[model samples]
Target: MLDVLRVTFPFFALVLCGYLAARWRLLPLEAIGGLNAFVLYFALPAMLYEFGAGTPLGQMLDPVAFTVYLACALLMVAGTVRFSLNERIRWNDAAFGALVAAFPNTGFMGVPLLVALLGATAAGPAILTILIDLVITSSLCIALSRLDGADEHGASAAARKALRGMALNPMPWSIALGALSSGLGVRPIQPVMATISLLAAAASPVALFTIGSVLARSQIVAAAAEHGPMPARDFVPVAVAKLLVHPLLVLAAGQAAIALGLPLDRFTLSVMVLVAALPSASNVSLLAERFEADNGRIARIILLTTAAAFLTFSAAVALVGPRG
Candidate 1:
């Protein structure tokens, strides 16, 4: 237990530090955007690129693991969307809800934390999951949102927008380039590799702090209060789907893959489960707000899941242990 805490405590502590800094005005809220940009646009991509560039191409493109993970995520998204529709939730709001239920915070928190917990090799699966969510899950949600009359554009336009957004995202491109380098057996020059290492090193602490700062700025309690009591009927299910159901599905899928003799290994399976167990990405709420969905509800879901994740993640790590 102490061993587990030793590993998990620093991650949460950095988050707490950020939360306190924001609460005490030690780090002004406005600074968060710049910090986030640094992580998203620079640090994270470099970290992933290095991982991909250095890892064997086969490991980087573990098709069995990627397929299983994607299947589980799609199932969760479909189930959530269906349930929301049955409950008479607006389609656009339901789409965003589905996103909250399915999209894990793989980039900001998952990548760095898993790298720490499972080592650099975990980066392959982590990056794969991120690409899956960004490219597939997000596109599905955007299409649904459009169907719900949220957009003036049609489905084709929604897809084009999604594709364009993904193309513009540096993470996927970095992963691709890194994989290309690995495949071609080309390594970055020493100076460039050193620079990449420096940026990658900053990813974990800065990203964790940024998460806490964002949480502090969210003022979840105030949002809940102003919105009145959250409709338990609506909120509880989404939170459960994200924090509990999502991980279970991933675990089930991985187990099934192994039983069927897929090349999935225990450590990669554990990494997939842990990543699935992460709270909904903070950006889900932002997406909701942008699309004029139920942003308050999404915000509360992010808060609840994130708060609960410490225990859930710690328990998961203890049960799964780390990759040998």
Candidate 2:
């Protein structure tokens, strides 16, 4: 619909701009990391903090929404792992594939864009999705990745490392502080709030642009590398799982929850579905490279879902969107 397009076009256009800029060397690939660091370390945390602090803890995250979304993510992980693991592939590749299929780019893209489309209140559910992905889904997938040939030490080590990384992550900490502030009625002083406001305002455009640049950089790197034969089967199905299947699972599960008489917020359910509809988390490519999985396949899936989400995600927004 024209109405939906009007809401989504600029966000996707910024993504295209970032993609073009990186491809054209306007944003050198080396510099993409720094831009991402800025968003991750500064802009995004502040944005989450403000949203968390301003919202009532109840509205900040719906328990029913969390359970439903988590269940959907777990289901996606299991399903993708089952589907992707075949003759050649092992748990490492399939686990990361499952991760890509389960994790959406909620922090970098979904929070800001969804809030813009739906309003500030959407931030609670959007941020809640980030917590689920970072804390549970990613950790579960990475732990599963080591299941191929690892001893108990290696497996436990991988899980510990994952939890440690989550502890170091600033986004979750900011969300907690924000919730604490909300809980205790602790409002910030004018200047501090103003700084957070500015950073939060910058979060959307910068994060979106960085997502485009990261996708471009990944593609550039993958193309330059000595990539092995990547059949469409290896990547395409996983990409489809991310852009299409994940959201559908969320929708179906949430609807079922509502039928079961759970207290799921209608707007929260819509936000959760849209968040699930977002492309595979771009950072999954980095995780793949880190764990020595097939980065080529992971990057392709991220790129494919991101590019396709321009259409699929828009349609999803229109379908579940509040305005509609």
Candidate 3:
């Protein structure tokens, strides 16, 4: 346990520091916005490219693991919708409720933490999971929310928009390029690799701190004012699905994969499981606000789940390297 603490403490400390900085307004909120841009547009894409490019395409793109991830995401979304309907949730409320239950903070938090804890190699699975989360889970959330809005044109328009967005997204493109490089056996010179390393190194902390800044600005009280009642009682179930049930299901699926004689490294699988366990994304809160869909409830959920992830992450690490 003490050993686990040593590995986990530093990462949590960084988040704590960011939260404190935000709470104190030590940095302007706009600083976070700039940092977020640098991370998203530059550092993160470079990191993804280098990591994705460097990985053996065969291992990183395993069909079975990918299938398991997709299945888990689909099941969670379906379960959330069913539960929401049974509880008499309205359309927007149910949409946001399902959103909370489905999406993970795979980009802002997952990339950095995976690189730190599991190394560049582990990043392959994290990146894969991020793709799954973003492309599939995110699109589903948008569709459900639009349906609730009674927007007939939304489904088709949103599909086209999502396809275009994904096609143009730098990180995903970088991943595609990287896989191509790996497949073609194109290794860069040492000096070029060094530059990629430098960019990748800057990705995690900047992203994490920027996320903290965003979290700081979330006005839970104000969001509540606009989005009907606060729905405090309804929150627990969403939190459970996000912070508990989802991860456990992923873990079980991973274990089954392992039992099937899959050639997966335990460390890689652990990275996937941990990334899968992350809370409802901060972006979900932003989207909820944009669509006028219960931002306060979303904020509360993001805050609670992110805080809970610290302990959950430690447990995940212990599961992976209990003796380390």
| TM of each candidate vs. truth | 0.92, 0.96, 0.87
TM-score, cand. 1 vs. native:
0.92
lDDT of 2 by residue, 197-247 (tens): 899888989988998898888887777784466789889989998998898
Model 2 ranges with Cα > 4 A deviation? none
**How close to the true structure is residue 88 of candidate 1, measured as C-alpha lDDT?**
50
The lDDT leader among the candidates is 2
Model 3 alpha-carbon miss at residue 108, Å: 2.5
Instruction: Put the candidates in lDDT order, highest first.
Output: 2, 1, 3
lDDT of 1 by residue, 170-247 (tens): 988999998999899998899998999999888888888988887776664336546466578777788888988998
What is the per-residue lDDT of model 3 for residues 165-240, given as tens digits with 9 covering 90 to 100?
A: 6676677787887888889988679998888889888877777766666666665234537646656676777887
Worst 10 residues of 2 by lDDT: 148-157
Q: Of the candidates numbered 1 and 3, which has the greater lDDT value?
A: 1
- Quote the lDDT for 286 in model 3: 66
Candidate number that wins on lDDT, 1 or 2: 2
lDDT of each: 0.82, 0.89, 0.73
**Descending-TM-score candidate ranking:** 2, 1, 3
Clashing pairs in 3: none
Give the better candidate number (2 or 3) by lDDT. Answer: 2
